[model samples]
Target chain A: MVERALLLCLLLIGFWGVVAKKNIIKKIFGLNILNAAAVMLFILEGNRIGSEAPILESGLAQVVDPIPQALMLTAIVIGVCVTALALALAVHLYQITGSFDIETIRERIQDET
Target chain B: MGKRKAWSPTLQACLAIGAMGVVLLPVFLSQTPWPTVARDYLMQYGQDESGARNLVSAIYLGYRAFDTLGETIVLLVAVIGTMGLLSRVESLVNTVGDDDNTIQTVSAFSLRGDKRSSHVLRTHLLEVVTGKIGPIVLLFGFYVMLYGHLSPGGGFQGGVIIASGIVFLALGNQQDNTSALSKSSILGGIESVSFLLFIIVAMSGIFFGKGFFGNPLADSAYPVGFIVLLNSIIGLKVGASIGFMCIAMMGGHD
Candidate 1:
């Protein structure tokens, strides 16, 4: 329960960073934090039913659910893809506006028109 | 007045996040039990069916292989998008010889040390250390990738490590960044070829009457051969694409 609360706090912290942070890079950082919180939550849930890792060794039962772990691997890869794309977008924005600040980029775009 | 204006947005953001948290509270606090039937079933037959000791590997590379293919496609799309976006953004990183006053920007792939003979910041130690360690890391990545069926690591994990190894190789070359692995063209080729091979292997199962992503070697003495092949292919594809992107980002042209 305490772990869940801590993960919730982490999720909120990531949300705050995404919503309140001005720098696009920091926003990406927050997005990763959010991704981490999610992956951790899934893993934690899977841990509830197992005393061993998902590897099948001799005389080992009660192994954690491998489904969540496999699913989370896909999620982690997708997260990486999203992050790389976001960072590239940020770079393009920086190249255009010459600033990482969201307000400044908005102002630059508005001025451009 | 200005201070209050700055503080108000923070407060608003907090309230918004708090609202989201409240809405998500039931989800986080839910006491429902996770289903164990799948785990139990997989534990009993996953090894025999997939020939993988690691059940997680068995799931991704065997039972849910179609999802792996989809994820790789997503990764490829991301790489393509990044390449298109970063082509124009290269000017941002290729800032060589604009300022001669304080610090000179050298490309990470630059082979000419004589061009940068002024006030070096002790880069020799870093170069020597990472240069010696890069190939070792690549070897370890391959080891992890190949042994994933029997171990904790898998294609994605090993691939990320391999990409890091490539980055280290790119960074370590003080005289010449001629490592074939660091070249974007080579990396791109490897990625493309591996993806093609992955599809070919997937379709090969169709000819064997096992359907897509089914193990064609199910009747062979070593059924695990298919999983190992898939793991290696995925690892190479991921490592190459990521290394390609990282090299491009590091301003390593050609």
Candidate 2:
């Protein structure tokens, strides 16, 4: 219950960052935090009553779900790729508009159009 | 402007937070963790079927090899997209002319700046430290990739580590004469070749009467060798692709 609450709090914080922040980079970071929270939630959900590391060693009765761990690995990689792509886009936008502020960029686009 | 002013930042934040809370409330309240059936199956037959001691490796390389392939393709697309974005700046700089002053100003504007002309920016300590530790880091990445089947670390982790070592080297030494374009192309070629080899291996499983990505060498003496091979291929592809992305994103301003 505590873990779930912590994860939800993290999600809320990330949501606030994304919604309240004006800087595009900060929004990207907020998105990353959300991704991390979701990954942790999945890993936490996979914990069993008597779980050990999912290695094939002798004398191990229970093992945590390897499926969630593997899936989370994929999620983490995808998050990284998405972050890189987003940063690239941000850099390109910054180059063209000379600002990181979303509102200013939008205003400039409107003026140009 | 009037419409935008109606919703202040604090109000927007509160609304978002409240909405998220409401959406997540039920999920958090009724969280009954269920037992996974696949866990039992994987733990029981993972070693014999996949020949990998590490259960995660068994699942990643054997049971869900297709997903790994898809992930590598996603990485490849990201590398390509980053290169596309950064190379435009490089071309813009080149077309602007041969004037050194203009080139310096343009590169500075483009975020790569002139590294060769600015000698004072070079720090001797960083150069020495990276030179000493870079090879060890690369070796460790190799160790992780090679021993992935038996250990916790795998291709993605090892590849990122190797890419970081390359980044450290790139940052520490500015006097290297190799053009960024050539280096990027070489890395791109390696990425493509490794991905192709991965696909070929997947196809070879079909040729051997096994299903696609099915373990053809499961009955062989060294059953785990195929997983090792797949891990190495993925590691090389990921490392090269990431290295290419970093160098490309740094732009060819050097």
Candidate 3:
């Protein structure tokens, strides 16, 4: 129960950080936090009520749903890629301009307009 | 006046908290018990089909290996894109003179100004946290990836953990050189090796005359070990790909 709540908090914090932060780099940090929290939540959710065995089982028994765990794995990899791409864009944006702040970048872009 | 000015921050805080409460409510409220039907279906059919007791591995390596492959490709594309967009080769050459100027500014400014005190304070705090907490997180990530076959984590989960650790390193040490540790060649090599290993493992069944990506000799004693091996391979691919992608983007930047 406590673990679940912690995971929930992580999810929320990550979301909050991404949405609220203005600095592009800080926004990336929030996205990472959010991704980490979501991945942790999926792993924790896959936990058997009392058994430590992964969703894998060899014999005739009810194992945990490995599907979500598997899906989450893909999700984690994709998340990392997305974050990297976003950060790379941020760096490029920084280079073309000279600031990590999103508002400044936006204004500089607008000025070109 | 101070209190009056606090409302903006307070309002921001309130909106943040409220948004969180709303996002979390549905996830918490809608709970479903693990279905007994799934448990039985997997136990009976998965062992015979995948020839592994661990149903999760069967699903991971067998059922959804395609998804894994797609994710790996996503990472590969990300690195390539980052390299194209953010490679420091041009910047390094073009800004060599500017780099020296900034370095001089940083060093000189540090020595004789009030900024030095704050810089020293920040450096000390960074050293303290990165030195202490960083290794623990890295180790935990390794354990998560390694023991994924037996626990809740697998290659994907563990890979992200490891990538996060690398990100932590980048965060603490903003020096461009620190990021170079995850070089393109090194990361590219690890990513390819692991990916190839996965293909070989999956094709083992085809070579052995079983079904496609199926293990004929899986039942006696070695199938379990093979599954575990494949899990580790997947972990390596996912972890290295993610680590490489993250490092490439940041490391190659000016």
Instruction: State what share of the real interface contacts each candidate retains.
Output: 0.88, 0.66, 0.53
For model 2 chain A, give the 10-residue run with minimal summed lDDT. A42-51
lDDT of 3 by residue, B1-254 (tens): 25454556547866886878787766744466655555556656776666555566667766666676677678778867766776642442233244433432222211223433344233657645764565676788888777655566666677677766765664454332345435557657777898787777777778777655565466666555665676677666666667666555433333
The CAPRI classification for model 3 reads as acceptable
The order by descending DockQ is 1, 2, 3
lDDT tens digits by residue: candidate 1, A14-104: 9988999999999999999999999999999998899799999889969999999999999999999999999889888987888899999
Stretches of candidate 2 above 4 Å error? B1-5, B91-122, B174-182, B252-254
On residues B5-38, what C-alpha lDDT tens digit does candidate 2 reach at each position?
Answer: 4766788789889998999877765657667788
Query: By the TM-score metric, which is better: model 1 or model 3?
Result: 1
**Candidate 1: regions farther than 4 A off:** B1-7, B93-112, B115-122
For candidate 1, lDDT tens digit of each residue in B56-169?
Answer: 999999999999999999999999998988887656534434464645333333434665333244267877888899999999999999999999998998999899899889
Positional deviation of residue A98's Cα in model 2 after best superposition, in angstroms: 0.4
Please give the lDDT score at residue B103 for candidate 1: 51
Per-residue accuracy of model 2 over A1-113 as CA lDDT, tens digit each: 88888898998888887889999999999999989998998888887434798888889888888888889988988888898888888777877776779999999888989
Q: Compared with the true structure, what per-residue lDDT tens digits does model 3 show for residues A1-113? A: 77777777777777777777778888898898888887777666555432435454335243456666667767766776788788778767877767788889889998988
